[model samples]
Each structure stands twice: as structure tokens, then as C-alpha cells.
Target chain A: MFDTSTFIRLLPELILLVTALVVIFVDLYARRRTALGLLPGLSIVGLALSFLAVFAQWGTREVVAQTLAADTFAAFFKMVAAVAVILVVLASVRYMRARTRYVGEFYAFLLVATLAVYIAVSARDLITLYLGLETLSIVSYVLTGFLRDDKRSNEAAIKYFLYGAVASAIMLYGFSLLYGVTGTTDLQEIARRLLNGDVLVNMEWLAWPAIVLVTVGFAFKASLVPFHQWAPDAYEGAPTPVTMFLSTVSKATGFAVMARMFLVAMPALQSSWTALLYGLAVLTMTLGNLIALRQTSVKRMLAYSSIAHAGFILMGLVAVTTALGQPFNGLDGVLMYVVAYAFTNAGAFAVVAAVEDGTGGATLDHFAGLVGRAPFLAAAMLIFLLSLAGVPPLAGFAAKLFVFAPVVRQEYYVLAVVALINAVLAAGYYLKVVKQMFFVEEPERAPFAVARSMRWALWLMIIAVFGVGIFMNWFAFMASQGAAGMLGL
Target chain B: MVPLSWYLTVAALLFVLGLYGVLSRRNAVAILMGVELMLNAVNINLIAFWRYTRPDNVAGLVFAIIVLTVAAAEAAVGLALFIALYRLRETVNVDEIDLLKG
Candidate 1:
């Protein structure tokens, strides 16, 4: 049953897994040899190869009988995940080497984490989706605690684990309920059954609870409000590079799976879930922004800010239906917003990682007169913060435009107003960081040398931020193809 | 032959009880136990649904087994994290694990 054609389809995953194993073994020996750089070099080669593998599999909807999705929707996220992971590996080279001894395992786990994202975005079956999410979750747990000697790292891992375990279990129960009602694990089959009405004769009431429960699970993963208790702590305590991965790649997995499940399996019950997300969007945006206002720790501030961004992304999902042109469906806005935000937030976190490296912490005190100490780092951070605040000529601007346009067009006037207000409130804190860097009274501190790899990662993020924004046409087209693949059903 | 609701009822009770333990427990290990119970409840529900509804298909059975296996993995990882925490701070009581805060 396992044919060569299936092998061709799964080429990217195969290459990543093989790279992970090779890194682990080579690192085991490299440790005794003190050859610190080989694993990252090998990992990047694997990532570059998978980039080609994913490209090879493009426009694959015509492919028959594959377990995972071959559509542009999944393909788009695979691209995003690859970009994020590559940036993270580039940046973490020196930082991680300074902190831990298991450098090879770190690189290996990072590769496996990327494979998890590939599985998740491509999942068409409930069981496969569960596997993808759990794989990412477990990998994240290990990565968060990788600094075994640090008490804070241990605390963060336990908090993340406790929250993650219960959430996934609840989500599993939700999946079981859906399975009981539909009697099929395939998402399309479940949709067909749900829409048939006869299949739901008396079990119709179960659908609502199932949706609510399933959402609880994904919401926790996505770190939406009320279920977001662990995010700030975990982000604040985990090593900064892992924090970057968590906020960008891992969070994207949550939205990818959420969008697929709702848009594909449960569009028949659109009104119910949309309404649910609407309330979550408001609460998440307002609370995430408000609390971010108080965090002195820059890392915790970014954590809450990421949660706020999740709310902004949810608005795109809420306003799913639109007369906006092809691929301009609410989901495409979510996709474009995500693609843009990935670069911007990553750049922001990369700067934070650098500052932490120099100052031994990431608080306002560390940032004071940053321009005098590290003019280039401060300037790059300023651009990232501006982009995040939706200033024009940056990726965050394009992201906000794509998402907000849909909500305005849908005439969700209240949600639009709330989101707009939150945007302003969010700007207040972003500028606070800017103010610390530029307006402080501290004397010039000596500049610290950022590793070459870290500099390269920052440059890539900054360019992508500008590139995605100014060249919005190309990314919009890619996102349009992705959304079309999903809803063309 | 037992009715389906009997299994579902037992599962729901177990789930709620586990949730209670998770909410109220201070010891990290006890909380892990609570999470294990919740996962077990999910397993029971999956098996009962499979047994009663579609005995012909293996989807339900397969899902239950996957959950069982993953749950063990989750517990193992959780325990490892707890042990690391215990060694660092000399206590695994979550209430005392307060180094990271607002």
C-alpha cells in the first residue's frame, strides 16, 4: 500500500527526519571534538532541501489518495514554518552554545519541531491533526526546559506541560465527541455527515458542545485569553530563541489547524463558531493589550503582545465571509497577516535575544540609551516595533490592513471599533520601548559584538518585513491561492 | 449488555473529578496524576463509542490506542520536568514554584 508516489509526496518530512538523526549522532561525537558549528550547518542544508521539496509538491491538489493535504493552504504554512525555523537556528547558534551542553539535541529537536509543523498544516484527518499538535507540544516542552540547570527554565516547562496536557486531553474528548457523532475521522467525511441532517437526527445537540470543547483545546494552544495563563510565564522563563519559536511557528500551527477544522469540517455550523470567536477576539485583544501595558520585563511584554496579535488574527476568521475579491476571503487575510507578522515579531524577538545577551536581562533598564550602546540593534528594534504598531511602509501595516479591511467590509462595526481601539492601546506600549531606547539619560555603554549568525538572522527579518510590506502584491497572491485551495471545496 | 450512557456517565464523572484534582492540588506530581485521569477518561469514552457505534471499523480503536500511547509519553515528559524542578528548588509543589511572575 505504501507506494513510491506517496514517498515523493512526503519528501520534505523524510529529509527533515533524516537530518535530525544525523545531527544527533554527529553532535554526540562533535561534543568530544568541540566542533560546535556543524549541526546548525547541517540543519540549514536540510531546511533548504525541504524548501525545494515543498516547491516540488506545489499545486498538488490533483494528486489522488494522499493522507495529508496537498493544497496550497497547507503549502503556504509549510513555507512560513521553514522561514521561521531557519531564522531561529541562525540566531540561536551562539546564544544556545553559551547556555547548554546538549547543542546537538537542541538542533535535532528543532528540526523535528519543523517536521511537526509540516504534518499539522497538511493534516486532513482528525487523528493526524492530533498527532501533529502533540508532537509540536511535546517538542516545545523539551525545548523550553533544555536549560536543565536553570530553575526558571524548569518552572516554565512544568507550567507549559501542565497547561498543555489538560488542554490536549480536553481537545481529544472534543475529537471523540465529533467522531461519535459523525462516525468518521476524515474531516471531509465528517462535514458531509454533519450537513446531511439525517446523520445528526437526534445527535444534533452534540455538535455545539463538540465545537466549544474542541475550540478550548486549540484556543489553549493558540494562547487565546482565559486559557492564556501559562504563556507569559513560559515566554519570560524559556530561553529567548525558544520563545521566538513558540510565539511564531508554534502559534501558527494552532491557527492553521483551527482554520482547517472550522472552514472545512464545520462551515455548515459557521454562525456558531464565528460568534464564539468574535467574543474571544475582543477579550483577547483588550486583555492582552491592557496587561502588556504593565510588564517591566520585555519578554513578558512580548508574550502578552503575541496573545494580542492572536486576537487580531482571530478577527480575520470571524469575518470569514466577504465579497472581497478572490483569495480575499477572511481566511486569506489571516494568512497574509500571519506571514507578515511572523517576520516582524521574529525580528523583535531576535533583538530581544541580542539585548539579553549583552545586558543579562531584557527589562526597561537594559534598554535605556540602547542607541548609545548598540545603535544598530536599537534602530532595527525600532523598525520592528513600528511595524508591529501598524505604522505604514512595514509588514505590520500590511498585516493590519488585510485583517481590518475584512472586518470593516463585513460591517462588524463593534468588533472593528474594539480592534481599532486595541491597536491604539497596543501602540502605547510599543512606543514605551522605543522611548526607553532613544530618550534615556544613561551614558554610552560599550558595544558588544553580536555573533555573525545573529546579525544575518536580524537582517533577513528586517528585509522580509520591508519586502513583504512594500511587495505585498506577491504575498497576497500566494495567500489568495492558499485560501482558494481550502474554500474551493 | 450495558447501555452506552453508563460508559459516558462514568467518563464524564471521571473527567470532572480529574479536573477538580488538577485545580485543587499543590503537589506537582498530584497534578500530573489528575491530568492522567483526564486522559484516561478520554480513552474510556473513545473505546465505549467505538464498541457501541461502529464495531466494524477500526478508527475508534486506533484513536484510543494512540491516545493511550501519547498520554504515557506526555506523563514521562511531565515527570522529567518535575524532577528537574524538584532538584533545582528542593520542592515540586507548584505553589512554591514562584520564581517567574508578573
Candidate 2:
């Protein structure tokens, strides 16, 4: 069943896996100075190749090796994951080095985590998806506490681990229920059986409960409200670069698998799941923003904001449908939003990393006069913040437009309105940082100078934010294609 | 042969019990133990379903085995994290491990 063609479809994952292993071994033996430069460099090269592997498979739409699909949908999310990783690694170089001596292992773990997400989105069945998510969780737990000596980091990791382990176990129970109902672990087979009514009615009722239990897992990963207690602490405690990874790439992975599972395995359960997601969307958006509004710490504020963005992303899933060519077909908005948010959010966190690097804290006092201290960082922070607040001429605006349009089309006017209000609510906090940077008097300190590598990554993120905004129509179309391509459009 | 329903009921009860432990336990290791119990419940559920409905198919068995492996891996990582936390604060009680509150 598996052949050379299948291998090409699997190439991105293979390349990343090998790179992760090689980096670990190389770091073990290489001199410290050489290892530091070589590890990040090797990781970027590996990720760039993986991104190309995904790009090259852009139009190929087929299930490979029975459990993995090499389609545009997976490729789109994988591309987003790859881009997010490369940028984080570049931005991470100096930031991570300062926090820990095991910089090489950090790069290796990052690669492995990326590979896990790639597997997750591409998975066509329950087993592969479960394993992929668990791997990501295990690695993320370690990364969250990478600052082994730091009490806050350790607390965050253990909290994250407890929550994550419980969520995944609960999800596995759901999978077992689905397996029992359909007598199969293949997602497509389960969907077909459910749709065909092959299972007894009592047995059929199992799928609903199964779906609810599984959502608990996805929600924890996405940090939806109620399951989101770990997020703010983790985001506040982890080293800033790891926080960037957790918020952007890791969060995107959660959405990727959730979207693929719903769109692929539970198309028959659309009406039910949509209603469920609609409630979640409202709670996640409202609660996330309300908590964020009062946060004094900028990092904690972003954490809440990211949870709200996940809620916004969930709206696309709620309004999802097969009505191709309709503007804001729900899935496209999810895909577009994931891509746009990854770049914009990572950029915002990078600015956090830069500020925290210099000031040793991300509190308001630390950022009292950021513009005067580090003019370029303050300027970049302005762009990232505006984009996040859904201001026009930026990626966040485009992302919000597509996702919000679908909610309106789906007649979820209440969700749309809550989101719009949340956007405004969210802008209040994002702009708070902007005001602090631009308006506050310059604090007493030496003028800041960002690391050269981080400066380059920041420039790339700025260009992407503008490029994604101006060329939104094209990205929107690509998102449409990716969503449509999953169903063989 | 034990009926599938019997296994299902037992596993579900075990899962709820484990969930209670997770919610009620203060020690991080105890929480990890709670999670292990829940995972074991899932495995029991998987195997029972396989034996009852799809005994000829190895998918269920494979899934159960994989879950077993993953649970071990998760426990390993969880314990390591707890050790690190314990060293820092001299306790595994999660309530005291609160340096990250807003």
C-alpha cells in the first residue's frame, strides 16, 4: 500500500524527524559555541525544506498509507506550522540562550513538536491523531518548564501537564466509544457507518457523548474557556519564546486537528456540533476578553487575547458547510485565520521576548517608555498590536473579516455581535500597551539594542502582516481552496 | 464470556472515580495517578469492545497497546516535571506552586 509516492507525501515529517534526532546528537558532541549556531541553523534549514515539501504537495489530494491524507488542507496547516516554527526559532536564538544552557535541546524539542502537529493535521484516523496530539503534549510539557530552576516555569508546566493529561484521557474515552459504536478506528469509516445508520440506534447515541468528551480534549488544547485555566499561567511563566510557540504554532495544531476531525469524520453531525461550538465560541470570546481587560501584565493580557482568538477561530468551524464559492465558507476562515494569527501573534510575542530580554519583566512599569528605549521594537509592537486589535491594513483585520463574515452568513448574528464587541474589548487591552510604549515617559535605562537575528525575524513578521492584509483576497482564495480540497473539490 | 455492557459500566465508573481524584487531589503526583487510572479505564473499555465486536480486527488491540505506551510515557514526563517543581518549592502540592497567578 505504501510506495515511493507515499514517501514523498510523508517527506516533510521524515525530514523533520531526522533533523530533530540529528540535532540532539550533534549538540551532545559539538562544542558549545558551534552547537548554538549550528542547531538553530540546522532547524531552519530543515523547516524550510519541510515547508517546501508541503508546498510541492499543494494540489495532491489523496489519502496515503490509509491513515494519513496528503491534501491541500493538511498542507495549508502544515505550512502555517512550519512558518511559525522558523520564525520562533530565529527569534528564540538569543532569548533562549540567556534563560538556559541547553539551547540545542530546545531547538530539537521544537522540531519534534512541529513534526507532531504536522502528523496530527494530516491524520485521517483516530489512532494517528491521538498519538500525534499526545506527543505534542508530552514535548510541550517539557518545553513549558525548560527553565528547570525557575519556580514559576515549573508550576506552569505541572499545571499544564495535569490539565493536558486529563483532557487527552477524557478524549481517549470518547475515541473508545466511537470505536465501539462503529467497530472501527478509521475516521472515514466511522463517519460512513454513522451516516449509513449501520449501528443500532442506542449505539448511535454513543457518538454524541463521544463528540462531547473529545471536544474537552480539543478545547483544552485550544484553551477555550472553562478548560483554559492553564493558559494564562503558562503563558506568563514560560520563557517568552516558548510562550510564543505555545500560543501560535501549538494552538494552531489544536485547531487544525479539531477542524479536520469535524470536517472529515463528523460531517453527518454538523448541526449538533455547530450548536455546541456556537455556545463555546460565545463563552470563550466573552470570558477571555473580560479576564484580559483587567490584566496588568502585558504577557498575561496576550494569553487571554489568544484564547479569545481561538474562540474566534472556532466560529469558522461552527458555520462550516459544503456550500463552496460562498464567501467565508466557514472552514476557509478557520484556515485563513490560523495562518494570519500565527504570524501576527508570534510577532507580538517576539516583541514581548525582546522587551522582557532587556527589562527582565513584562509589567507596565517595565514598558513605561519603550518607544524611547527601543524605537524599532516599540514601532513593531505598534504594528503587531494594531493588527491584533483587528485594525485595517493588517493581517488580523483580514482574518477577522473572513471569519466574522461567515458567522453573519450563517445567521449567528449573536455570535458575530459578541465577537465584534470582544474585538473592541480586546482592542482596549492591546492599545493599553501601545499607549504605554508611545505615551509614557522614558524610563531610566540604557538605550535598547535587539539581537541581530531577532531584528531580522521581526522585519519578516512586519512584511507578512502587511502582505497578508493587502493581498487578503488571494489568501482568502487559497484558504477556500484548502478547505474545499479536503473534500476533493 | 463477560458481556460488553458489564465491562463498559465498570470502566465508566472507574473513569468517573479517576476524574474525581484528579479534581480533588492536591499533590501533582496524585493527579498523575488519577490520570493513569482514567487511561487504564479507557484501555479496559477498548479491549472489551474489541473482544465483543471486532475481535478479528487488530485495530482495537493496537490502539489499546498504544495507549498503554503513551500512558507510561506521560507518567514519566509528569514525574520528571513534579521532581523539578518539588526541588524548587519542596512540595508537590499544587496549591503552593502558584508563582504564575495574574
Candidate 3:
């Protein structure tokens, strides 16, 4: 018999949903000016408590009626999403209050979006995954246009909505094709059927197309090269907190879905998809870095850099397929990279937001000699840029090393070399930001005040970035364990 | 009874038409309509698959419902964005909204 315990297993998401609704309700009764200040703090506490609840359930695996699978991987991503929510709330307390209206709604949406990401990473069946992705995407669409008074924000929101809708539809169509071919929406069941060899081999042509469509859908979410057209403008146009949310938590969730689907369910079809991932890995990394070099807007540069990092994560996927003749072990690289990326990218965006607060703009020129004006922000930005460039003694370098280690172990020398070259190219642009900040003359009349909450957020993010790198082995172990559980090994 | 291929082919054609509309149309609202058309094509394929392949299981039916709900949410947010853009720039043309272009 179906039981109430099943519903209890989803307590964290329930809490978030309740909090979001309560925030909406409470905002109506409170003074408008103070509500903006009070709501984000309340949401942060709720998110932190939800994270604790999810943490308590770590290592407890359950298949919720063949739809959602509450597992360690879900717990790991939930923790990450919770961290993202906390940082977003902290960053937005100052950023949103000064620039945008409807602050309570904004914080509520962020929490709801985090809940969606949690569900997305945990979804065992196709339907649940689709629902989760759509939820995340919809909230993001609204958040991107939260600054409705800003023309760029409005434009960004429209473009994001149109492109995201198309991608979701394509993804759904692909899911339908898979369902048609396999007659099952449960990933595990589909994997078992495919491994049986008779149905799959007999319908190889149909199977290939179905796989292609499914991949295309996931690829759009991951923002792989060909499907990444929406990222830059959207990241630039959205308020800075939303940009950080999209770049870190949203991208990480996309990879989680990709890892779950391809590594677990579609391992039988590695022969077909592995080569495709390799091509995408090379293209995404190269294109993202090359284009980022020319961007004058700091936000857009990070946007492209995030796309490049997506490519780096794809390399780990490629390693999973080609190296060790298995996909499971390759996930360690992906997990570590994501953890490292979450901290460094969030820290970088925090610095950008701080700079934006000071100068009231995000252009590259605005950051000239930022070190002279705001030494702490400059130092934080330097650390983030260096970490992003994969410099030694930083989390980004450790992430790259983890990703490349398996490739070397498996002797995929050429792929590792390509990744190395991309890393070097990435450093060129990241260093450009650093050089402009520290070595150039201070731009006249740079606004240099950072809100206390934003400053704390930046410090925390920087400390996390450096701490993870310094304790690389421990971080790697946690990442590897999470990956191992996701692969069910 | 209509063959499954007939339904699939029509769905594919509708998807292509939607893609064409999204790519060629300058108006944001038209692009949204195109997106809706594409989602409808997907819904058709899902229901057809459920009817033909997984008749015993209702997962596909459940997924179709979820997709429809999501599509509605997407349209709401999208139209809101269009309204916002219309108010800000007094136009919904995609080409005219390229302020951040390099």
C-alpha cells in the first residue's frame, strides 16, 4: 500500500514550497520598504533548514513510486542548491533593494527555483525530470526579467523564454520518442530492456534517433556549444544574483540530469554517444573561451566562461565513456569540477556585483585599477579569476586535475592535451580581468561602497574557493563518493 | 484507425513549422506562438506513443499532463516578459532589442 512516509521523504522540498508561499503572503501584510529587507533573511534561514533536513537523509535511498529517487546524489545537489540559494539571497539583499521592486517575490522565486533543481537532480523517471526542469526554467524566466523597468532585462527575459521554451519542447519530443521506442519511462527499466540486446539491436536505427533527440534535449539545458545561444545575453541582462544562480546551480543541475541519464540509464548506448560528447567537449570549451576574450562586459565574459566550464565538465563525461570502458568512474571528475566551479564562479560573480554596486555599471573599463579603490574586492576578484583560470593552489586547478587524471589513467592523451590548451586559453581572459583591476590607473570617481551582506557573501565564497583547493583530497573524496552513489556502485 | 507513423509524421512537421516560425519571425509574441506549436507537437507525439507502445503504463500520459502544465507556466512568464519589453522599448521586435550586441 502507498504510505505517508513517501511524502515525508520530500520534507525539504515541502518546506521550501511552504516558505515561498508564506513569503508571498507575509509580504502583503508587511510594510513594503521593510519587507524587502526582511524577506531574504527569512528565506535564507528556511533554505538552510531545508538543507539540514536533506543532509539528515543522506545515504538513505528510496525510489518514490518509480518517479523520484531520493539518494546521496540528490542530497549532494540539494546541499549545493541550498548554498546557491543562501548566496543568492545574501547577494540580492543589497543588489535588488537598490535596483528592483518586488523584492519578496524575487527571493521566493529563488527558493522555489532551488526546490525545482533539487527535484530535477533526484528525478528517476522522465516525467518528474521534465517537470523539475520546466519549473526551474520558468522561475528563471521571471527572475531574468525581474528588473522590468530596465530595457535590457526585458529583452533578456523574452529571449530566454523563447529559447528555453523551444528547448523544453524539443526535450519533451525526444522523451516521447524514447518512450515510443522503449515503452517505458522508468530509466532503470529502459536500461534493462536495452541491455537485453534483442529489442535494441532489432531497432537500432530507431534507437539511435531516439538517443540523439534525448541528448539534444539535455544538451540544451547544459548549454553545450550549439545550443548555448541564450546564455550570454540572459546572464548579462538578468540581475547579478540571477546570473550567478543560472551559471552555478542551474548548470550544475543540468549536468546532474545528464550524468543520471547517460551514465546510469543509457550506458548501453555509449558507443553511439561517446564520440558525440567528445566533439561537443572540444567545441564548447574552445568557442566559449575564444569568444569570452572579446567581451567588454564583465557579466557577459563570465557567462561565456561558464559555457566553457560546461565544456570542461563534458570532457569528464567523455572520460566516463572512453576511459576504463565504463562511465561510472568518470563522474568523480564531473562532481569535483562542479563543486569547484560553484565556489569560484559564485565568488567571481559576487565580486562583479560588488564592482557594479560601486560603479553602477559592469563594463570592463569600470574595473580599471579597482585594486586602488577597493582593495578587498580586488583581492577577492583576483582569487576568483585565478581559480577560474585553473591556477595552482586553487580549487579550479584541482578540478581540472581531477578531470584530467582519469583521462591520463585511461590514456586519452589527446583529449587531456586539448583540455590543457583550453585551460591556458581560459587563463588569458581571466588574467586580463586581473590585470585591469590591479595594474591600471583607477577609473575616476569609482563608487566603492559594498553592502555589509554582500561583503560577507563574497568573503564566504572566497574562503570556500581557497579552502576547497587547500583541502583538495577531502573535497575530492566527497565528490567521488557522491559520484559513486549516483552511479549505484 | 490512424497509423502511429501518421501521427508521428504530423508531429514532426508541426515541430519543423514551429522551428521555422521561431527562427524567421521578428516578433517576440509570434516566436512564443511558435514555441507553443512545438510543445503541442511534442504533446501529440507523447500521447501517440502512450497509445501505441505503453498502453499498460500511464507514465507517458502523466508526462504529457506535466508538459502541458509547464507550457502554460512558460507562456504566462513569456507573455509577461513581452508586455514588459513592450512597455520599455515600445516594440516587440527581436532585432530592435539588441542593445548589448558586440
TM-score of each: 0.98, 0.99, 0.96
State the lDDT at A398 in candidate 2.
94
Better of 1 and 3 by DockQ: 1
Which structure is stronger by TM-score: 1 or 3? 1
TM-score between model 2 and native: 0.99
DockQ, each predicted model: 0.81, 0.88, 0.77
Give the alpha carbon lDDT tens digit for every residue of A171-250 in model 3: 77788777777778888887887787535224445677777777777787788998898889899988999999999999
| Better model by lDDT: candidate 1 vs candidate 2 | 2
- CA displacement after TM-score superposition, residue A22 of candidate 2 (Å): 1.8
Which is the better candidate, 1 or 2, if ranked by TM-score?
2
Deviating ranges (above 4 Å) for candidate 2: none
The list of candidate 3 runs beyond 4 A from truth reads A1-4, A197-204, A321-328
Q: What lDDT score goes with residue A124 in model 3?
A: 85
CAPRI grade, predicted model 3: medium
Model 2 lDDT per residue over A1-489, tens place: 778988888999999999999999999999999998899999999999999989988988888889888888889989999999999999999999988999988999999999999989889889999999999999999999999999888888888999999999999999999899989988888889888988744667889999999999999999998899999999998888899999998898888888878877888998888888999999999999999999999899999999999999999889887865677788889998998899999999999999988888898777888989999999999999999988899999999988988889989888888998989999899889989998989656778789998999999999999999999999998898899878555
The DockQ-derived docking category for candidate 1 is high
lDDT of 3 by residue, B32-80 (tens): 8998899889889889988976688887788788888878878888888
